[model samples]
Target: MFSPTSFDSRRRTLVSWLLPVALAGACSLAWGQSASDWPTKSVRLISPYPTGGAPDAMARVLADKLSKKWGKPVVVDNRPGGNGFIAIDAFKRGAKDGHDLIQLDSVHLAAYPYMFKKLPYDPAKDFQVIAPIFKSFMYFVVPTNSKYQTIGDVIADAKANPGKLDYGSWSIGNPVHLGMEELAQIAGLKLQHVLFKETTQLYTSVANGDLPFTMGTAGTAGPLIKAGKLRPIAVAAPYRLPAFPDVPTVAESGGPKAPYEVSGWNVVAGPKELNAAIREKIRADVAEAMAGADVKERFINFGYESLALDRKQLADFITSESARHENIIRRAKIELD
Candidate 1:
């Protein structure tokens, strides 16, 4: 007599044994050609950020390095705008064969679904997240002479004078904007949201004290800080930045437990139907490019931490990061229409 419990256990045991075999077969089937046969033509690297920015610079570096490695032209196509939708749309339409790849910010893959009422492309279905290139931490910056000296001071002032304080960023729902929104909720601040059309004017406004606060990466703000034009009120990170050891994290800088500690990250991915083998090859190539001394130096200058995670590590990292953003969106009560 076969008990129901025994039958279910037997089924579970069978699946556990067959799952790996099936996965291996699928991988082999997708890996139809040798590495030399792959990348048979020129590759297009689509970028969401405009030219002359950190993302564009990094994309070009990887393109040049990969082009040399593959013996083909690797071109960077800049389609920056619409909160990265422009480039993502181009990638979906351009590369059915998986040769064309796009650089994506983790925020786009994780936060946009909850930030907007409708997204044009489904993050999980429209692309395959090959691997992460690097991560960047944000800093809470104020004018050098501002009365506010710490992140806690800014929050208290906002509370003391509700809706009187304002912060600036280039776009809506970007990590810069969303991080501030989350911070306000955590610190119970009533502040005004300010938008700018370009980063140049935005940082300049902060330098001139037109805005009370803004978030900037080290590459973006470090020069100004070193020039004695801007002061870092606090860093929105888990630990103190090694470059600026004198500065403190949000909590260390006297703010309430912050909701904006997760650093921003960028990834290289391709069309969802990209061959498993090809995807794996691209991931490996990109990792090697990142490991070069010159590549690391450029990223350092841009205030990025190179991740270069292996396949298993990459999968686990993306999954954990997505879950963190989902929790933040839910807690912040952020829903766009």
Candidate 2:
């Protein structure tokens, strides 16, 4: 046992095991440091919406705040069109160090999976959804001088004259269309859907009495509503919004008694392999950024309600929203190419 050759061989065996462990510990330490010093360079916040829209405004405000916080440039790269695929694909191919993030809406995360037969991106695989930035409720908008006074009037008319009452939205599977269809299904009434190319055309048609009604947001239909061209019969929210205190909720207006609500929201998402520490840091920083007076004012101007949900709560919200969209899509037989 005291032989020099035997002692040398034992020492060599111990060195092999210790070397790997030493290297692993060093790597872990370096990775931790890298995470702590995240955004080692400039960060890019990608947006699917074009400039001047609410989503772009949101991205820009966050970029400004985060840039100041990290002492590095945080630029918003707008890659609008292709139903948000352009921005998503760009993000997927962009920096792998988590310096690039994407802003996604409820349609991309909740409705599209069921609407599209083969989606370009996988929600569960491609994204690490962080948290919701804001949510805005849609109102049941009608012409001001119309015969209907409340949502119940519309429902009763639909029941009395099945398939006569119709609604409009910009697209087939948008929240407005889906929510209205869900309401019709719940109340056992037949209603028709009218499609428009954009919100202006949709709401204008409603104002002109060409379209009976359509779901609209304050930001989109506020001008007409304020001009006394369109009337908001009810808002699809659990409770009344502070800005519109007089408006009743969908339930209060004799909608489904089973608690129905329709809203559109935006959330920031990162690459699937984003580091955990950096992710948490970004979430916390975003929350702080949103709490600022400037961001709050922007939200108010956009008619958006700030959502301060944690990661788990956001995940659950997405799941529930996806399920709700699936139910309506299946019932309404809506499938897009």
Candidate 3:
């Protein structure tokens, strides 16, 4: 017969060991079930822009297709304003089960971190990159009848006039604003920045000759250029855009070829704590969705190039872009006011 104290100690040891084994088995089972039963309910995709913006349009299209593919409802929640902070806040506070997705852009991911001294979220720790949906080629546009016919001409004029030449963008701290500043920095010139509250107003001002020129994504400027209201002087991309092959790239148009390309991008991201398996699944699904015929056609029509990079590649791109934009922000002295 065992002593009473020895018997109690043996029982406690056995219970502790058994409890851990049981818990591990239960957790494994739950993870497997979650992976298998994902999309049993609706998935919410949050767009940081207003309902009519390009990001909103892309999210809606993707949500519809994803809904059909997964056999569940896919809803797009538009929470515009606050420089994308509003949407990001909502996403951070939402469920961490991979049921909620957020659409992010370069400003939110790359520029904001450097522009603001005190950011509310950390890009590396607060969110994970799911997939890169699309990348739009940026173009330097001026009035169709403006004196500047090429990128070289703009650079020359800026060198001569210094701060007299002014460019307009939709807002401060946007890619358009930063890209132009980068161009000026590279070309060794100076120019004034004019901020507009609305995109339509910005383009209209450019078309009507209120401003000399502006940098804009091809998707927004394509229609205007095709309609003969604006002229594409140069494409600020790694290579010439297929849609505007006749137009020369920044390198080809006699601008400094120091890899000064910038564009508006759409990406899928989730809360930082999302399960790895769920995150990968969403990333794969987005890649497939972007490759679909309808999705490809829509992107082509809008003058956007499909990126469709996997999780690792997307993460690498974001990291590199963050570094690149941080340097630009520091050199340009851009602030979020």
TM-score of each: 0.86, 0.87, 0.88
Put down candidate 3 lDDT per residue, 94-168, tens digits, no spaces: 877778889988788777766765667766456766678888878999999999988899999999999899999
Q: Report the alpha-carbon TM-score of model 3 versus the true structure.
A: 0.88
Worst 10 residues of 1 by lDDT: 17-26
Candidates ranked, most accurate by lDDT first? 2, 3, 1
Highest-scoring model, TM-score: 3
Per-residue lDDT tens digits for candidate 1, residues 234-263, read: 888877776577889998988866445847
Better of 1 and 2 by TM-score: 2
Candidate 2 per-residue lDDT, tens place, 248-331, comes to 998899787646998899988877666666766788898899889888887767767888776656665676687688778777
RMSD of each: 7.5, 13.2, 12.4
Q: Of models 1 and 3, which has the larger TM-score?
A: 3
By the lDDT metric, which is better: model 2 or model 3? 2
Clash pairs, candidate 1, are none
- Angstrom error of the Cα, residue 18, model 3: value is 37
Badly placed stretches (over 4 Å) of model 2 are: 1-33
